[model samples]
Each structure stands twice: as structure tokens, then as C-alpha cells.
Target chain A: MTDMYDFFNFILQIRNFVIHLQCSITLIHNNNMIEIKNLSFGYLKGHWVFNDLNLTVEQGGIYGLLGPNGQGKSTLLYLISGLLRPNEGEVTMNGTSTGLRLPSILSKIFIVPEEFTLPAITMKEYCQLNAPFYPKFSFDELSENLKAFGLDTDINMASFSMGQKKKAFLSFALACNTEILLLDEPTNGLDVTGKADFRRFIASHMNDNRTIIISTHQIHDVEKLLDHIIILGKNGLPVIDSPVSLIANKLCFEMIANGATPSQNEIFSKPTFGGNNIVSIRTDESPETEINLEMLYELAAEKPSEIKQILLNN
Target chain B: MRNNITQDKFLWSRLWMHIKREILSNMKQIRWQLALIVGVVLISEILICSNAYDNWKQNDYFYNSAFQDPAQLPILLAMVALGLFIVAIAASMTFSSLRTKAGKINQLMSVGTSAEKFWTRVLIYGVAPALFFLTSVCIIDLIRCVLVDSIMPIKAQFVIINPFIDETRVKAILLFCSFTACVSSFFTTVSVYSPKHAFLKGVCIIIALQTLGSWFLFRYGNILRPWEYHLDLAYWTALGVLTAIAVVLSVVSYIKYKETEL
Candidate 1:
């Protein structure tokens, strides 16, 4: 009986070792992406902005981080970029803790904060001073981006207006060619034409190795450019975090023409100019439509668990 | 350039580039500071020269008596004090780039290790100011002395002030240099600990530390009498304590710099 007990114990130890090995391998596989695990943070003590939050961002997609005010959308980006630290757990990029601020990690990441102060120097000098740090910085690309934004490289940044400054900075940031780019309120100061240019710049620069996460309240400005959407709910919990393609497959967004009856599968609706916009469960007969960001946000805000269940069921 | 991986390991090339970036980025502010230093020193020295000439013209023997020593001790002391003042200001502004939220993000996100950034500030803000102060003040004094001698009718024996004129003066110079270094490092650490209004905070902390130290010494004077019996031991002990303090402050500054968050 003693021999039998020892044999079982040895087998259990082997099983545990195998499980641990598999976990290690999974971590190695996840090294190429950004991972946030069990992260809790707050500006003040005992007033938690996020509690036990977990997220994973992969490469090759433009992700929109959306939520209401004070939901920690901007704070989350800062945490990922190493501008802030978590009270618990970790945020890692390429298998390294971002909070460490290692040069290896810093060189690969760039963040365009909502409000920034550009030095009182000409754009040419600015590039000369800052571009050497990122080995992949491209002057040609910078010129092209600046041209797209209708800016000149010789202009003095000190004299530019806030909108112009944002454009110049956005041009430079995209030209840096970093692996991960975090943009907060990128279109806040841009004009209508500039906003369209901004979208074009983003769409043209994206590549398979790059991951851009944009946090903005201007959902209409980014809806067309996004391939993934992660919406945060109250207390900084994710209401829905999924690819746009998956969201489109499980749900249908449409404009119900005037005098038409509401569909039986409707989940949420909002009144509009000519008709009512609706988000509903996708059915066999439902024609595919582009995702309506405003309607989708309302649904996620009003019926978070219902949407989560629908996304999970399929 | 193509996408490449960077390492946290110390590299001479990277440090050199980081230092260059710091200088170029702050070139405008540095130029203004340089102008201010030169302007203040020039105006003060000229005033002193003019006042001496007026005194000599009115009372020949009286002015000669006062100006006998070409290397005036008080003037040398004044120059050292000015240098320390410059060092204090420069050191206090070492982390000025971290003052604003945007500036803090730009600096912290720059591609360099924390050690590289810390040492760069120490060299630019702490060491460079002291060197510039020494060189510029000495040259200015030389010019002032020569110009005054040529313009005055009487040979007043006006010459450049030298800190190494005698043994006592040399020792005094050494003491002042050590004090200046300690002050510079203290302000450097203060900049890291308090980036906003760092100069004001540093001054307050210095005044507080001096008062506390004096009080501690007075309170424990009787208990420390044994050290007085062995002067050599006391001297070495004091030196060791100072060296340890400097090292600890530097290490603490580096650690604090590394852990800074927005």
C-alpha cells in the first residue's frame, strides 16, 4: 500500500510539471504581443479605476479603445506605454515589463498624448534632434505625411496653431515606424479636412508588424479605420473586446427606413434624421452592413451582458 | 534606417548621442543662461573697477594701501561664491524637462536607459556649469586687471585674482570646491525628487538640513568629545562620512529617476 501511494504521488508531480511547461511555452508565444493581466490602478487610494482587468492586443490591427468619460481609456494607453505603472500585476510587451522603461522596450513604442508641447524649433531641427533614437525613422515618409497634412518641413513649430502643431506631430509620429503606437484624442484639434487626411495617413501606414491603438471620443472619425474594437464599461471593465469581423458576424447594424416596423431581433435603437438606426442579432435573412459605432456604443453601454452573451454564443 | 532591436546594456555610442540630443534640444535655453552669466559678471567687475579708480583719484595713498595685494582674497572669495551660485541654479534645473506633463512624457519616452539620462544631466547641468564658471571668470578678471592698469596713471599692481597664491589660499580653495560639489550634487538630487520649482525647494531643504545638523552637533557635543582627543581620526572620519553621503545621494537620485512616473 505504501508503494502504491508513492507511485501516485510521483505521477501527480509529473502532471504538474507538464502543465507548468505548457504555460511557459504559451508565455513565449505571447511575447510578440501586448498583454495586460490582472491589472488594477487608480489615481487615489481605495478608488479603483480598474479592478482585475485583463487584455491582450495582437499585432497587425488598428484597435479603437472607446468608453465614456473617466472610464480610464487614456489611462489604459498610458499604462501600456510605460507612462504609468499598475498597482498590481503587470503590462508586458515582447516578454518585457513596460514599467521597467528599458531602452529596448522604449525604442519600440511611441505615444502621442492628447496634450503635448512641441519645442520651439523648426520642424527640420526637431527631426534632427529626435529621429535618431528610433532606428526605423524615415525622412521620406515624414515628408510625405507632412505633405498630406499640408505642412512644410521648414516651418517653425513655435508659430503654428494648435491644429497645425497636432498635424505636424502626427506626421512625425507616423514616420517613426515603431512597432506599437498609442494615440489619445488624435483628432480633437483637427479640422474636417484634416480629420479625413488623418484617416488616410493611418490607413496608408499600417503594416502587418505594426499595432496602433487609438483612444478617442470621436468614434465616427475612426470607425472606418478600425479592424478591432475594445469598449470599456464603468469601473474600467471591458464590455466587449473582439475583432470587428466577429462583431459583424454575430450582429447586424442597419438604418430602419421611416414607416417600417421594428425587427423582432433588435437589441438597441436610436432615432436619426431620416430613420432610426438599429443594432440587432444577425439572422439568416439579414443583409450585411457596416458597423454603426454610435449605436454599438449605446448597446454596449445599456446592454453589456446581453452583447457579451451574444458574442460568446457564436 | 531599418527597424532594429535596442538593448539596455550600456553603450558609449548611445550615451554620446543622448548627450548630444540633450544639448541640441535645450540649446536656446542654454544660450540665454550663458548670456546671463557673462552679463552679470561683466557688469559687476566693471563697477568694481570704476569704484576703485574714483577712490584712487581722490586719495592716492589710501587707494594704494587698499589695492596693494593684486590677488585680493575677498575678490577671490566673491568669485567662488558666484560660481557656486551658478552651479546651484544649473543643478536645480537639471530635471526641468520633466516639469510639464507633455515634457515628462517626451523625456521619459526618449530612447535611452535611465542611467544614461541621469549621467547626461550630471555632466551637462552640474559639471559643465562649474567648468564654464571657472574659465569665464578667470578670463574676465585678467582682462579687467590689464585694462585697468593701462588706463590708470599710477601702477596699482592690479592683476588677476589667483586662488593658488599661497598655502592658506590653496586650502581655502580646496574647501570651497568640495562645498560647491556637495551643493551641486544636492541640488541635482533635489531636481529628481522635486522637478517643479526645484530651486526653491532645494534652498528650503538646504536651510533645513543645515539647521538640523547644527542642532544635532550642539545637542551631542559632550558625547562626541572622544573624537577631539585624536585629531587625525576625527579628520578621516569626517571625510569618510562626507564621501559616503555623496555616494548615497547619487545612488538615490539614480533610483528615483528610474522609478519616476507621470
Candidate 2:
């Protein structure tokens, strides 16, 4: 009996190993799904929001785009999604220029803007009208997402409160199941419980063949789910690195008592109600800890050169 | 080449889907307004028919002698002409939502090509409303004729003029359609560029065009209307020019739509 159990366990382990290998292969195949090549864009002729910006977002994992107000985080997403044209350079998806907006290419991208107008129709009708455009749209996923948000697909969308409408729109956006999902300020109107559910839903929906880009100034809302964070400076240049690398290489975030003296390695600090939250360069003896995205954003905004050197070296 | 063909097929399918969606949404949005318009027009037509029938019954010989010829029904002609204005208004309303920043973002982010969006608006706002208006008019006229025939003792006959049956009526209809086509296309093009108050802009454009046209005619009327000037040739030339302008405007609208930025 023991020998037979061992053999069955071995067989199960082999099967699991094969499944893991397949997932990795699929991820490798979709690497570098979005490539932004020297993109320059601005709403006006003489002014530019992003100048000669280059970015590559690979498939799989959620990317948190962090920036202060007016840093053009949302604009970058729009340019990538082809909603706005770049003044110079191009954004390509799977080696095809997104400017063309070919039907097949559009089918793979979905964007949930910070502000939008849902037609005066029921959620069901809205989905019926739009779902056909995306070949991979999943009705089951839509139902699940709506239920998670405490919404019903049959409700009239026009009657929904702002938060409820955002929830409904986000549900539909995720249900589209496009390979690339661009979300701008997705957690803006969500309540506490709703925000938690939003994060959970995004985490559950992630797959090896998909990429999700979320742009928001509210860093804490999405900090936990982000595998990589791209912080855009006021000048539009971005410092892209993984949260793990950021914590391990350059900074160690800590909460000390208010009025504590600054340490030699302290890079930045901000006083909080209970304590002084601090960002300092990681020393040989300093242990790695959670990254405070808010501090990082503030530090990067104030001294982009210093942060850029650290991030680039890593 | 094979890949190009496949891409084109995909785009066409998506365009058809977009057109159907726009048609359904527009119908839902304007159904009540359309019903109200039809009701008002039908009631007015009924009253007019009733008065005409009463006059005919009072003096059958005089009515027959004065206006019994089978010319195009003036009321129908007038209604068709009014329908063109309605079409222009509808065309201007097509992209009214684009006036708002939120609405513009929603539209640009939606999964459809610029060509698909442009053509869908053209069909829904420019073509479909005109056809609907004409159909409503015909139905109202038929009801009017029935009521007049049944209520009058003199049995007044209201001849429903079919434009296709007579050459002159056909030409008049062709000219009217050409004019409507030009006006509707112009409004559609205006809607693409004027993000806010597109209808107002369209009205201003129409006023400007009319003023220019009047000035031209006033200045060159004598020179163009000499004894040898053929009116038919003038009409045809006008039609050709208007059609050319409409085509050019539509192409410009498409190009502008394709290059639109949020």
C-alpha cells in the first residue's frame, strides 16, 4: 500500500511540473508585448508631456505606473492604447504599429479611462453592444466580476452611482479579456471593500499571456499587486524597476518615532501621525523591508537624478 | 497579400458590427422624439385634408377645374424638403457626445476603427433619418386620403403622387435628394471638427453658404441667364458641383476622424 501511494504521488508531481513548464513557455512567447519607441506627445504644438520616451512592457504581471499629477502617466497609457497619437515615434503591439488601429490589433487592447460616459442604457445592453467587438470576451467572467462588485448586469447603467458605475465599467473591461488592459485611476471612486475586491479581481484575472498597466497617483491603492513600478518624472522620463529590486538594492523603508534624528544613510523622510516614515539607502547590515511607494514617489519627484542612478545601477 | 485580404475582411466585419450597434442605439435614443414628430405631422395633415375636402364638397366643379392636374403634390414636395433639414439636424447630433472630454475619451477607447466609426455615423445620421422621415410622411398621407374619402359625400379623390411615375417629378426628387445629400454631408463633416456646439457651427456654415450663393446669383444673374442659357443644364451643373463638394467633404471628414486625438 505504501509503495503504491508513493508511485501515485510521483505521477501527480510530474503532471504539475509539466503544467508549470507550459505556463513559462507561453509567457516567454509573449515577452515584450508592448514596445514604445522614442515616443513624444503633447496636447499642444509647442508643449510636450512625454519627450522621446521609450518603454517596454512585457506580458504577464501587473505594472503600476506612478507619477505626480500632470506627469502624463495617463497620457502614456493613451498613447500605448492608440487613443492619442504621438507627435514623434510610435507604440507597437506585437511588432505592429498601434497607430494603424487594425481591428485585430484593437481586439487585443482594452482601456478603462479615469472618466467616461456610459450610454443611457442597461449594463446588459451595453455589454451586448460592445462585447462582440472583442472576440475573447467572456460572459462568465463578466457575471463573476459584477457579482464581486455587488452589481447586477440587468441594472440600468445610467442610474448607477459614480462608484457603482466605475465598478460596472471595470467589470466589463476585465471581462473583455484583451491581452493588454490599460486602467487609469481605477480605484478612484471605489469604497474600501470595493477597492479590496478590485485588487483581488485583478490578481485572479492575471495570466501568462496578459499584461495589465494601471496608472494612478494613489500608490497605496495598488502597491501590493504591482510586480513592477514605473515612476514617471515631471520631465516625462521614467524609472522602471521591480518592487523587490527597489527594496533590495537602493532603499529600506522604516517607521521611526516622530522627531527622530536622521541617520547617515537616510535618503528621504516624512513625518506621519504616529511616526516618521523614512527611506534610506540599504546598508550591508540593513534588512530588506516593504517599500513605501508614497515615499518613493516623493523622493523620485524631488530628486529624480539620485533615484535614477540607484534604479539604473540595479 | 493574403494577410492584407484577411485584415480587410476583419475590418469590414467590425465596421458592419459598429453600424448595427449605432443604428440600434440611435433608434433607442430618438424613438420618442420620432413618435412625437410623426404624431404632430399626421395631425396637421389630417386637418389640412379635412379642410380641402370640405371646400371640394362645397363646390366640386370649381375645385376640379382649378387644381385637378396630376402635378407633384405640393404638400408632399414641401414635406420632403422639410425632411432634408431634419436630416441635417440629425447629422449634426450624430457626434454631439464627442463635445465632452469624457465622451471623447470613451469613443476613442472603444474597439472600432476610425473608418468604421465615420461610416456608421454617416449611415445613421445622414441616410437613415431621411428615409425614416419620408416613410412617416407617406404613411400620414395615406391615412389622410382614407379619412377624406370616407367622410366626404362628394368622394374627393386625393391622388398620391409617385415621383417615379413621372419624369418631371423624378427630376425634382433627384434634385432634392442631391441638395439633402450635400447638406447632410456638410453637417457630418462639421460635427467631426467642431467638438462643441456642432449644430450651431453647422447652422452658421449653412448661413454663410447661402449668403455667398445669393451674392453670386445677384451679381452674375444677368450674365448666366441670357436667352441661350438652358435651365436644365444649370440645374445639372449645380447638382454636379454640390455632389463634388459633398464627396470632398466626406473624404476630409474621414481623414480628420482617422487623425483625431483625445
Candidate 3:
């Protein structure tokens, strides 16, 4: 019986080793794209924006950077894109530290900011002037993009409307063909059709070698497209993970139109239409209920520590 | 290994595409600014030309005394416009989308482009305008001088038409622009730091400095460049110091951008 117990103990130890090994491998590989550890940022001194954040995004797919207003959504994107430096942490890309400017790293990343201005030139002139910076910038692809936008390559972008301008920026960003693309408020001025087109563009363009992080208040614009979602807490670090898997195993989102208090099924509950609460439950399976991003965001925002607990449990 | 393929593009090249589209999409805006700038230049030119023509046509010193040397009129005209464009680009670049130079710096900084690249963009966008305006004023003044000479009996052929520039003056212009642009690049860091009308802030800073400089001059006797603003020597030592300071500040700003989370 003693020998048998030792044999069983050995087997358990081996199993644990394998699991740890796999996790370590995943963690190491995550650094291939972007890596952040113990990151703390704040605009003003002693007033923190985010603190003790740890995150990793592997090469490829789309990351939805979700947060409430005044939360660090755009700030985080800017930090990762090497636009803004973090006050208390390190951000590394492709094994290179971002504290120093590496053209190799910079050339690989492209950011389409919330607001951008184009110069006074024809669309073709714009292309002619800006296409050579990125090694992957495809004139042919840019032309195709222009066609898709119903834009004449020869025409001036100055003639475009706000929506058209945004569309043009999206197309141009895609055309740059960088490995990492950071988009802030990409759907701001776009119409429903334009938004749909953007979804399609994201879906079609996402490649294994490419990673995209889009920051927006409107999570619906990116919910379907994101493979991972990194939700930032005001004055808190981040919890980054695959959205579907997170929703399935860690939390369940459901809308309740008649709840007055904490339902037995709810880990978190918020009011919905006609006095209903969009309640979230701790679950181990995909919730067949509706995906209400607003509610999910509220849960994440209102209870970051709780969300962290859920993440820890997962 | 085959899974994660990445390619690079030149930032300026990519920026140019956006620039082209922007220019195309906002032709009316540009047209308006252009019309305003050009109108101001032409109207000023006409006033000077008319005065000079009257002075020469009258061939009367008593009546022409108000006209003060038609030959020198272009220089005066250029000085007035210099002041105008400075104010204009500041407000235009900051307040409106007309001057996208500061915005581009912020964007470039966000994208992690180097300080060198950032400055290059500014030079093309910011100093390029200044240079263009400088040359234009010189050319316009030279043309005015020719016209004034044709009309006036007082033909002083060697009246420094582009009085603000020369061999020695080029050094000053280069140093001045370098100093100003280094200062202006603060707009990028400031805009990123605050994230509100960053462009406007950049413009305000410049305008405030100019106004302060003028006030200082008015209060005192001589012009005040403010905080080592001038290249006093136009000598190699001063030039070297200016270049080094410009480089350090720009690089420092770029470094500052490295930490700025947009």
C-alpha cells in the first residue's frame, strides 16, 4: 500500500509538471508580439490611471481594448503601439524593449488614431508620398481598398465627408500592412454599412503574423471580431484573455427585464430595458443568453477585483 | 515559423498617403486658407505698389514723404506678412485643421517613430512653410523693387530686397528655425500629455511667447529672444551650440514620447 501510494504520488507530480510546462510555454510565446509586466500609468502624479498591469498579446488576431470613459483604453493602445511610454513598467515587442526606439519595432506597428488629418493633395499623391515607410505597404492593395471605398484613386480626400475620411484612414491603415495595427475609435463616424464593412475588413485581413488592438467605447463594433479582449480598469491594471472562452468559462451574460434584486443566478446584475437587469453569472459553459457588451463592461468595471477573482479561478 | 510573417513600410511614405487623401478630402478648407493668405499678400502688395506708383508718378517729395522709399516698401511689406503668417500658421495649425504639422508630430510620436523622423516631418510641414514664405517674400520684394525702381527716380539698385536673409542671414534663419521647431515639437509631447486641443495649445504657446517677447521689448529697450532663444553669434560656436541643443531637445522630446502613453 505504501509503494502504491508513492507510485500514485509520482503520477500526480508528473501531471502537474506537464500542465506547468504547457502554461510556461504559452507565457513565453506570448512575448513574441507584446509583453507587459507590472505596468502602472497615470496622467497626473499620484493619481493613477492604471496600476500593476500584466498582459501579453501573441502574434496575430484582433484584440478589443474595452473600457469605460476616462479608463485607459486609448492610453493602453498608445502605450503598446510605442506612442506613449508607461510611467512604471516595461513594454516589449518581439523581444525588443520599447524604452528605446527600434525602427524594426516601429515599422511593424501602425496606429489609426481617433482623429487624423490628411494633407492637401490628391489621394494618389497621398499614396505616392506615404507608402514606402512600411516594407509591406502594398500600392495594389491600397488601390483595391480605394475601389472598395468607392473612391477614385485620383480624387482628393479633402472632398470626403467625416465618415468618408474615417473610411479612408481605415483603408490606408490596412494598406500599410504592418504586423501590429492599433486603432482608436475606428467606428466613430462610420455608418452601419461602413461598420459592417470594417468588420469584414478585420475578418478578412487578420493574419497569423499580424496583431490588431482596437480601442473603443462601443464594444459592439468589435465584439464579434475580437479573439481576445483586454478590458482596462480605471486606476487598475488589465485582464486580458480570449473573449469567447472568458465568457464561457469565467462569466455568463444574461438580460433580465424584471429583476428587483440579486437573483440566485447572478454574480452581477444591471438594469436593462423595462426594468430588467442584464445579469452575469459565474459559469463553466457558454451562456446561451444574449451578449450584452454594455452589461459585461459594467460588471468588469464595477468589480475589477471580482473579475480578477474569476480570472484567478479560471 | 511560416505563420507570423511581418513586413515594414516607411512611415513618411505611409503618412503621405493620408496627407494626399486629407488634402483631397479637405480642398475647400485649404482653399479657404490659401485664399486668405494670398489675398492678404496681394492686397498688401497693391497698397505698397499704389503708394510707390503715386510717389514716382507725382515725382514730388513733399507728397511722397508718407510713402517712405518705394524701394524699401517690399521689405516693410514682407516684415508685416512675416508677422501675419507666424500668427496665421500658429492659429491655423493649432485651432483649425489647416496646420496639421503639430497633429502629425503627435501621431508620429504615438507610432513610435524616431525623433529624427518626427523632426523631418516638422521641417517639411512647419519649417518648409517658413522657408517657402521667406523665399516668396524675397522674390516678391525683389519684384516690387524692380517695379519701384522702374517707377521711381531713386534707383538704389543694391537695396537688400530680401533683407532678412543673406550668407550670414542663412545661418540665422537655420538657427532660428531649428530653435523654434525644437520648441514647437513640444506641441507633440504636450498634446499627447494633455490630449485636448493639443494643436491649439501648441499655437497658444508660440503666440504667448511672441506676445511676451514683444511685451518684454516694449518694457525694455532691446528685443528679448527669451530663454536662450537667439543664435547671438551667427558664429560656428553659437551655431554648434544651437545645433547641439536642437538635437538634444528633439531627441529628448522623442525620448519623452517613448514614455508618453499617447
**Candidate of highest TM-score:** 1
Return the TM-score for each candidate structure: 0.90, 0.87, 0.65
In candidate 1, position B224 carries an lDDT of: 88
lDDT of 2 by residue, A1-314 (tens): 99997888788568546644654564467677888989888888868899899888987878999887898988888888887888899998877677767665677888898888777778888888888877778999999999989997777777999999999999999998899999999999999999999999999999988899999977888988888888887658885445555655678898899667776788888888888888888887988878788888888877778877776664
Candidate 2 chain A least-lDDT 10 residues:
A18-27
Tens digit per residue, CA lDDT, model 3, A145-256: 7677777777677788888888887888898888889999999999998898889888888889889988898788887888777777656566434565666565666654
lDDT winner, 1 or 3 = 1
Q: Give a tens-digit lDDT track for model 1, residues A4-34.
A: 9788878856854664465467566764479
Q: In candidate 1, which residue ranges exceed 4 Å CA deviation?
A: A1-32, B1-5, B52-59, B62-67, B153-170, B217-238
Candidate 1: docking tier? acceptable
Q: Residue B172 in model 2: shift from native, Å?
A: 1.7
- Number of the candidate with higher TM-score, 1 or 3: 1
Q: What is the interface RMSD of each candidate, in Å?
A: 6.3, 9.3, 9.9
lDDT digits (tens) for residues B1-262 of candidate 1: 2232365555567778778878887789888888888887777666666665665566665445654633344456567668788999999998888888898898899888888888888898888877877777777877766765676554444333366678655654555656677778788899998888988999998899889989999998787889889976776566566656767887888898889999
Question: What is the Cα root-mean-square deviation between model 3 and the actual structure?
Answer: 12.6
| Tens-digit per-residue lDDT, B108-207, candidate 3 | 5333244444444444444544555555555666776677567555553333334365676676566555555555545544543444566666668778
Per-candidate DockQ values are: 0.33, 0.20, 0.12
Off by over 4 Å in 3: A1-31, A99-101, A120-122, A139-155, A239-243, A250-295, A301-307, B1-106, B109-113, B125-156, B161-262
**Which candidate gets the maximum lDDT versus the true structure?**
1
Off by over 4 Å in 2: A1-30, A239-244, A258-262, B1-12, B24-27, B50-74, B153-160, B226-228
